[model samples]
Target: MTDNRTDPDPVADERTTLAGFLDYHRETLALKCEGLTDEQLRLRAVPPSGMSLLGLVRHLTEVERGWFGRRVGGRDLPPLYFSEPDNPDGDFDDLDSTDVATVFATWRAACAESRDIVAASSLDATAQRRDGTDASVRWIMLHMLEEYARHNGHADFLRERIDGATGE
Candidate 1:
């Protein structure tokens, strides 16, 4: 894939740096999924793992929605994929019947909403977590950066395994 991801500015302020890196990683994931058919996107990694490019997209959609929409934006929204105590892995596991276009659209929407939330809030602004602990916007962005970095590694492996294509 042609990498169009913009590198995070090394000397930018904390919020700018975090948001930039987060956007870079987000673009990385999309790059990994580019030029693949729906079947290719759903192709599983090695056995015993349900991970796929499509699954990663779906999972991150939930992550963005959970952290930004619910926690930060304080929107009372329902999970887009999995439900607790029932289908916890629904995002990754339930892909057979998913519409790729819808999943991608939802993910993009979630990301847009996250960007808006971050733009409007102070870095030090706090949100309540599931455990009743407060999480600052800065902390959440950092956590999201970590999450995307980790998952993008998986995306690398998955894309390579599928088509022998590889890059940062």
Candidate 2:
């Protein structure tokens, strides 16, 4: 298969570099999952982990919402996949009952909204956490970049296990 990932430029400014790296990792996650059947996407190829490509997408959706929607925008939003008191691991654990299209749509929407939020705010812009702690947009972006990188690593393994497909 053809490689589709866009490399982040090394000479870019801080903001451009951060955004490019985040986008690169995001695309890597999607590329790792491309062309797989729904059943394949949901298969827990790596035993004892309970992680699927679909679950990764769902979890990232919630992560995007938590950081960008609720924390950064201060919008009153309900939990996307799981609640605090019940089924907190719904994103990864409850994949069998999920509609693949809906999960993908939710993830896409969350990512778009996150990009919009970041675009409209200054890097130094601050937001409040649930615990009343402060977080800057820069920090949120960096945290999200880290989150995507870590999960994309999981996606790499899962994809490779699901099929022989590999590489960025």
Candidate 3:
């Protein structure tokens, strides 16, 4: 097996902008989730803490749809959580959707969509959330960055459990 251990600090340089932070985090999360099989990636905690690398990817995809596509782009896309099913964890409980090819394609699509949306708008541009509250593109970028950071931390532990290797 190939060793995937990284430098442990994915973002060593200062991300000077919110968009930069978002990009940095996206990369960091991808790193944490990398080099694992679908089985290893989808392993959940006891009774399922509803946590997994694939789950995080799904959740982040939904977040991208909500924050960037719907809010920032003014697109009325279907909400992935409330309308898709009744699962409180949203996209985290995908035990049956374990097809690696499908999950990978979906994740890549989500990342591409998010990048396009970010590229199309300025940081100061404002958009309303589903609740009709205002959100700046800057806010979405920063929020996603933070979200990825927290979840990637979870992924770190999960990966460690999957294999003895740990770092970054």
Candidate 4:
């Protein structure tokens, strides 16, 4: 893969720095999926692990919706890709018949909504978590950055094993 990701400026303010890094990681995940066919995307290249690039995309869509839409925005939205108790790993495992274009579009929309939610609130703004504990926008942003960074590492390995393609 081409390392087209731009680095966040170290001198920027906290919000800018966090947003930049988060955006970069998001783009990196997309880049990793680029040029892949739906079948290749759904391939569990790493084996034993049920994770596929398509699965990662679906999983992140749910993450984005959970954190930004449901929690921060306080919207009563149902899970987009998976449900607990049954098909908990549906996001990662239910890929054989998934609509690739729809899934990708949903992921993009979720990211856009997440950006909007972040924009309308201050970093200090608080929202209630599932346990009724409050969380700041700052904390959410950092958590999302961490989430994507970790998943992108998995994406990196999967991409490498899939095509011998390498690098950021």
lDDT of 4 by residue, 1-168 (tens): 556778899899998998899999999999999988899899896548899999999999999999999989888879877788887988898799999999999999999999999989899999888898999999999999999999999998889888878877
- Positional deviation of 124 in candidate 4, in angstroms? 0.7
Quantify all predictions' global Cα lDDT against the true fold.
0.95, 0.86, 0.72, 0.91
Which is the leading candidate under lDDT?
Answer: 1
Specify the poorest-scoring 10-residue window by lDDT in model 4: 1-10
Tens digit per residue, CA lDDT, model 3, 2-89: 4343333445543335555666667777777777787887888456376877787778777878788888887777755435446667
Q: What is the Cα-based lDDT of residue 49 in candidate 1?
A: 96
Error of 3 at 53 (Å): 1.2
lDDT value for model 3: 0.72
Q: Summarize candidate 2's per-residue lDDT along 1-168 as a digit string, tens digits.
A: 456878999999888888888888888888888999999999985567788899899899988899999888778878878887788888888777789988888888888888888888889989887788998889889999999999988998888888888886
For 80-123, candidate 1 gives per-residue lDDT tens digits of 89999899999998898899999999999999999999999999
Q: In model 4, where do residues sit more than 4 Å from their true spots?
A: none
Better of 3 and 4 by lDDT: 4
Which scores greater on lDDT, model 1 or model 3?
1
Of 1 and 4, the candidate ahead on lDDT is 1
Better of 1 and 3 by TM-score: 1
Ranking by lDDT: 1, 4, 2, 3
Collision pairs in model 3:
8-168
Winner by TM-score: 1
Candidate 2 vs 4: which has more TM-score:
4
